[model samples]
Target chain A: MAGKKLSIIVFSGTVDKLMPVGILASGAAASGYEVNLFFTFWGLNAISKNGMQAQPQVDKNYEQMGPMMMKRMMDMKFPMWHQMVREAKEVGEVKVYACSTTMEFFGLKKEDLADFVDDVVGVATFLDRAEGGTTLFI
Target chain B: MSQEAKIAKTLDVKGMYCPGPVMETAKAIKQINVGEVLEVLATDPAAKPDIEAWARRTGHQILDIQQQGGVTRILVKRAK
Candidate 1:
């Protein structure tokens, strides 16, 4: 059977939201699904070279628990969100895209993004890649 | 369990969680030849169901699934 595809629109930069993006991508890829991740807004910022190394942030509602959650994840030896995405790419067809409009709005260049980003794209390209597939806005 | 099948590889994903066991199993299946069996030993509660779903979706065959203590053992045959 031809593998189904999963399209995720990453709009949040918070670790809480990003973690699900990584986990879902890996889960779909493991089930032989092609994954398309469109990073926009804060999501695009989070994938930037500097953002990749920056301290993880949780939603304001969970701000107090963020440190404890991070510590627990670390103690459990859980892979970082980006690391999970990388592992997903290794097993199946997973493509990560950074929104060009977001980059321009932030005065960011392609070189400023993470190495795992497959390309800088526009909404049209993302829609084209995401057509006829399961789509999620995160 | 009925037929005696030879396992070509054994993947230990005991400490991994969620997609880890499934991802590892998918990668390991590629390392073996077609029709060769891949045995996955995982402790993740999701491993068995996730791997079973992966096998069904990828055209692979699940030969056996056995759980002992907290460990789950899965035997998968690569179809392609």
Candidate 2:
């Protein structure tokens, strides 16, 4: 088996993409790979305590289902993506970093995010850590 | 079967969304030894195709996929 470090750059603000970003990072870690998730722009919103409970970002499927129905679908705990991200972190070497530039632009503080974030850094700094293995953006 | 010697992990992900069951299965498979099998019990219509794709792309193998009622039981073998 090939063991490699995986680094993911998360740029989307919506919860839909953000959830997978975290899940994959955690999954990679659980599979015995070192994993890091860099959260930038709206993607940083996913780590907030409130974000966990908030409705996930709507997608094309959700759009077809309509808001009321989609809300119901989300409420049913079908996938429970948020909880997966949380659990994945608990069991793996997943680290979440907030993009410093995004934070500054939004006039947001790291404290404003949910409980999963580890630090705030710039792209240059994140790339330095992501130099080897696989890199993904979500 | 004795819990300790069960030799397999079962993840019931019937209603889980895209990437949800797949992610969980991947995580569970990682915990077991190389030859251990992972049985992902999913009701999600997407699990069969998505997991098959993931397994194929990642070098893992799908031992079997059985659909009963609306749920599908996908047995996967971790890549060595």
Candidate 3:
């Protein structure tokens, strides 16, 4: 049988949501699955050079807990979400894509994204890569 | 259990979480020769199912799994 595939469409920028993207991608990648991460809208912004280093923000509903959670993660020596993605790439076939439309909308160049981004692609390309796989939107 | 199934290396990933144990296992598996067993010692609650799933997907064989004092020990034989 062919190997399993996992595709994630990242649309949220909040740290709460982005954490799952990184964790899920890493989990699937570690399991020898092909992983594709399609970053769009706020998600595209999160992967940008500036955004990757920006302070992590939680959803408005969880704003009060953000600082405590960050502190707890720091105390536990937890890896940041981006670090997880990088580790996933090291262990498995993981491809990260930046949405072309989102880049144009935000005036972002290819270089504006984090170094791990494999390509700037459109929705059609994302669909093609995500076909016959388990796709998630985060 | 048998001499032929002896573990070649032991990867201790205790105190690590989800992907940490799995990622370490993937990397450690590469250091052993084909047919050699790689033993993983982890504390992550997900280690058992996660490593089993990883072995399944990677075409490796999981020879044994045991837990004691909250530590999980997994034996995986590299298939490729």
Candidate 4:
């Protein structure tokens, strides 16, 4: 299992989609895999300091069940998705990258991103790190 | 193999799901010395298979597993 890696191109900001990102990242890290999370588009918003403070929203299609699902998750004592990703970083070689292009488009500075973000990088840099491993676009 | 292994640490990951159990198990295994046994008590149904796979991948050894009522008890020995 030497040098095993799992890379995710996070494209969605919705809670439903982000949950799996945290779960998979943590799981890979726990299993001794290097995990890379490249946040782009809406996913980049998810790692912003302001974005982290806002209430998490599910997809509009699941709006009716959103409240119920949130309550159920709370009842089960599940950690928030971001918390899981943070834990992943604490336990293994997990790197969270914010997309440079997205940051420029949104006029976000490095300080606006979450503290956990390892770097603000371009597509080529992300591709180089994500090469030769399991890369998922979510 | 008939004798019981001494438990050095016990981790109760009852309500957590999926990665929680395995992650905690990985962390707990490090708290004890190599060759020491860890007893994990979990309620998640995936605990058995997940921990087994974790052990296999991490090179740890699973000594025994048992289910009583709703709880699953797994005994794993640190092999590294």
Listing every candidate in turn, what is its Cα RMSD in Å to the true structure after a full C-alpha superposition?
Answer: 1.0, 5.4, 1.5, 1.1
Residue B39 of model 1 has an lDDT of: 88
Q: Judging by DockQ against the true structure, name the best candidate.
A: 4
Write down the worst ten-residue block by lDDT for model 1 chain A.
A72-81
lDDT tens digits, residue span B8-69, model 4:
99999998888899989988998999999999999999999999988887889999999988
Give the true-contact fraction for every prediction, in order.
0.67, 0.18, 0.55, 0.67
Give the C-alpha lDDT of model 2: 0.70
TM-scores for the candidates: 0.97, 0.64, 0.95, 0.97
Candidate 1 iRMS, in Å? 1.1
Lowest summed lDDT over 10 consecutive residues: which window, candidate 3 chain A?
A72-81
Chain B, per-candidate TM-score: 0.95, 0.85, 0.93, 0.95
Clashing pairs in 3: none
User: Model 2, residue A133: what's the lDDT?
Assistant: 70
Error of 4 at A18 (Å): 0.4
The digit string of per-residue lDDT tens for model 3 on A1-138 reads: 365899999999999898888889988887888999999999999999999888887999999999999998787677888999998899889999999999999999999999999999999999999999999999
- Cα error, candidate 2, residue A98 (Å): 1.4
CAPRI tier of model 1: medium
Q: Candidate 4: misplaced stretches above 4 Å?
A: none
